[model samples]
Target: MKTSKGVKRRRVEKDGDAVVATKLRKEFGGLVAVSGLDLSIPKGTLYGMIGPNGSGKTTAIKMIVGRLRQTSGGARVLGEDSPLSARLADIGYMPQEMAIYTDLTVSENLQLFGSLYSMEREAYIKREEALLSMVDLSERRDSLVSQLSGGMKHRASLACAMIHDPEVLFLDEPTVGVDPELRVGFWQNFADLKARGKTIIITTHYMDEASRCDIVGMMRQGKLIAEGRPEELMERTSTSNLEDAFLEYSWRDSV
Candidate 1:
């Protein structure tokens, strides 16, 4: 698949360089949403970012996706500069809010998003059908998004985000309103993506879900307080779960 700019988009970049963020900072007036934060995500791994409200989770993602300008510092996606040109096809973003049109049916929304990349008609159908199946929304393809439940809408939104089969996926609180069963399914889907060598960066306040990540970055007051494998973080902080580890890290940071 290729973006409208004629950049060929692959399912996974062969020997793709992991994401790198160096001193990434974003400020708004007197408030610094992201403060000299640095991060790295390996290809084919699931990375989780967790923090309390206003800890810069969403702000960081917005900066990465080019929705907001950084006050200072820099970042790179797929080895290119932050907000790489014509790199939209290399990224699939699922925002916290459902970005799909409420009046459009699931299939219609998928088709519309597919057209955004100028995907070929037959190719679009294949990709759309595959995505709908992966999201378990095939049965509801003709249903209006407004009539679907919160979980269903979220699933639809996810499918639309990947309409172009991006190599890197940025999911901001993907499973927020999903039920436990659905959440588990979502994790399974993420694992599947990992198997295909897709780099995934997920942000959430959910501790339990953070455990599913290969590495977790705990953000505090617009800074990355700690980052490591889930078990490594727990052991280093002498805590049993990610939530407690985050609190322990925060207390130490304050000291």
Candidate 2:
């Protein structure tokens, strides 16, 4: 839990219990998307994935969630293979696109997804109320999704993902179209979830926001260029911010 003279440090456990990947790889025809990559996320930790477009960040996430089959690799989430029957109920996934039903009312949409996991109506009702209020959308409980603004739609999507109360949440670009004010609120919500022992893994292009992560994995061309706390990466790269540090790391990696 120590850092260099100019670096800030955050405490993260390096215990045996974690979400892990070893030699993870994916390919599409002649193209190799993710190649021999390894990642480990500790339980109850906040982890970030950062990279330029086409750097295989999305591919990596897809594999972790079992949406894409790996070409040659392996992954273990919460001590079991991802997509295994036992892990299905413990993982909540929020994709990059808004997955809400445009025609359904907020409550109806929640009920639809909630029921998919066999969540009882009574349990779903209780969670629905708490989640709706948490995201400041209680008044819109009966509004059709198409009536909400872009930010509100994102909020609704987040609520739907959490309705079943999964222990691990995978958010791919959760703040894409959110405004600054709402973005701040979103991070605050993430912090609250962390305090409650929920593990969050998110992918983002925003450098400033990436600093909020307990640990970050900077990726390039399907390979991990660096992995560490934000401040540790900055100090190691002799830079003041994540973007600059990423550039420095990429340069050194190429050399």
**Each model's C-alpha lDDT?**
0.88, 0.87
Estimated TM-score for each candidate: 0.90, 0.90
For 90-184, candidate 1 gives per-residue lDDT tens digits of: 89888888799999999999998888877899999999888888778999999999999998999899888888878899998888777888788
lDDT of 1 at 58: 90
lDDT of 2 by residue, 33-144 (tens): 9999999888778999999998898888878888889998888877788655688788888888878898999989899889888999889889999999877789999999
- Return model 2's CA RMSD, one decimal: 5.9
Off by over 4 Å in 2: 1-16
Cα lDDT for residue 174, candidate 2: 88
